[model samples]
Target: MTIVVAYADTPPGHAAVTAAVAESRGGEAVVIVPAVRDERVPDVAELEGRWPELAGRVEVERGDLGDPSDTVIQVSQRLDARLVVLGLRARTPVGKLVFGSTAQRILLDATCPVLAVKPSVAGP
Candidate 1:
């Protein structure tokens, strides 16, 4: 079984990756799908450089779909992934209503189980 990650370049995104690694049972492929718009997707080498434990086990999948939510769902369904992980950032109710929530869409649409994580808050 494989794990699918909705990746973005943010603290929440990093936390999701960390959570995915912890959830892995060794030898399960961790596939990353870029989950932010207008952001460059990190190369596999860059990902490995950031997370040494992901070396030789991480794969980036840029799905053909346009929307980030659609891409994540499409890739997860295509891979028949065992799990889909994504990070959630706090959003105001107005923001959610106006911009809509990619995380919410993924949670509702994904064929496999979705794990939503938030970044750890720093202590004062």
Candidate 2:
């Protein structure tokens, strides 16, 4: 089974990748789909360099879709992924109301299970 990740270049995005790796059962492929509009997709080599566990098993899939949320859903469905992992960042109520949320849409629209994670906070 494949694990699809909604990737961004942020703390939350890194956390999502970490969570996906942890959730993997050794043989499952981890496919990353950029989840932020206009954000560049990370090279597979770069990703493997950062997360050694993902070496040979990680790939980037830039679907032929426009919206980030739509692309995520489309890739997950196309791959029939076992899971979809994504990260969450805190947003003000006003900000959420105004901008809406891609994460929220993916969580609701994905046909498979979705794993949502937040960055680990450092303690004082």
Candidate 3:
């Protein structure tokens, strides 16, 4: 079963991915990082620096942006994914008022079930 986990340069994404894999049917997961324009994607080497500890848990597959929500939805439908996993970042007061969160977008756009996780820690 395909499990698509939304990844960012944050602990939430990593923790969310871990949670998703644990709850999945012990299948390989594809980690997707939506890289917009030419610079938004996080350096993979840095991402993997710590993730190697959990590397055995999944098969990572990154996705560069073509619209994060749209891309995730398409990937889900095409892969027939069992679940689309993503972390719901704590929205800032201004952010909540201005733009919606990616987690919300994914939840609404994905055809399959979406698992949203929020990590215990966060970054500024």
Candidate 4:
């Protein structure tokens, strides 16, 4: 099974992608970009440009538009992924309370083990 990665093109997303690549060790690394209803899908080229290392190493799947957590879960199940990797970003209590937490939902709902990583303070 492949390793599923949830990417948003953010710092935390970058961290997750990097971690997944390292963990893949030449295995499959499937990158899933979540798309909410009516929201435009992220540009794959831009993403690849931002992270050159992913060009040949990662397989990106910009799934149908929907809630991020749902998209991640669905992709993982469809792929029968062994693991789901996600990036965690620091958020204020109020922000989390108001915005709700995609990470929280993914963690609680995913069938396989989920790996959550934060950007290293030392920098990339």
Alpha-carbon shift of residue 26 in model 2 (angstroms): 1.5
Candidate 3 on 14-90: residue-level lDDT in tens? 67666765766643655554522122444545544555533544444545545766676777777788888887667
lDDT of 4 by residue, 1-124 (tens): 5888877667787788788877775546556555233444356576567656556645667566368788888888888988899999999999999999989988999999999999988856
Please give the lDDT score at residue 32 for candidate 4: 54
Cα-lDDT of candidate 2: 0.96
Rank order by TM-score, top first?
A: 2, 1, 4, 3
Better of 3 and 4 by TM-score: 4
Cα displacement (angstroms), candidate 3, residue 15, comes to 1.6
Order the candidates by lDDT, highest first — what do you get?
A: 2, 1, 4, 3
**Best-performing candidate as measured by lDDT:** 2
Error of 4 at 47 (Å): 5.3
Q: Write the per-residue lDDT of candidate 2 for residues 1-124, one digit (tens) a residue.
A: 9999999999999999999999999779999999998899889999999999999999999988889999999999999999999999999999989999999999999999999999999999
Give each model a TM-score: 0.97, 0.98, 0.70, 0.79
Evaluation by TM-score, superior candidate among 2 and 3: 2
| Model 1 regions more than 4 Å off | none
Task: Sum up the clashes in candidate 2.
Answer: 0
Go through the candidates in order and give each one's C-alpha lDDT.
0.93, 0.96, 0.65, 0.76
How big is the positional error of residue 59 in model 1, measured in Å on the Cα after superposition? 0.4
Candidate 2 segments whose C-alpha is farther than 4 A from its true place: none
Clashing pairs in 1: none
Clashes of each: 0, 0, 0, 1
RMSD of 2: 0.6
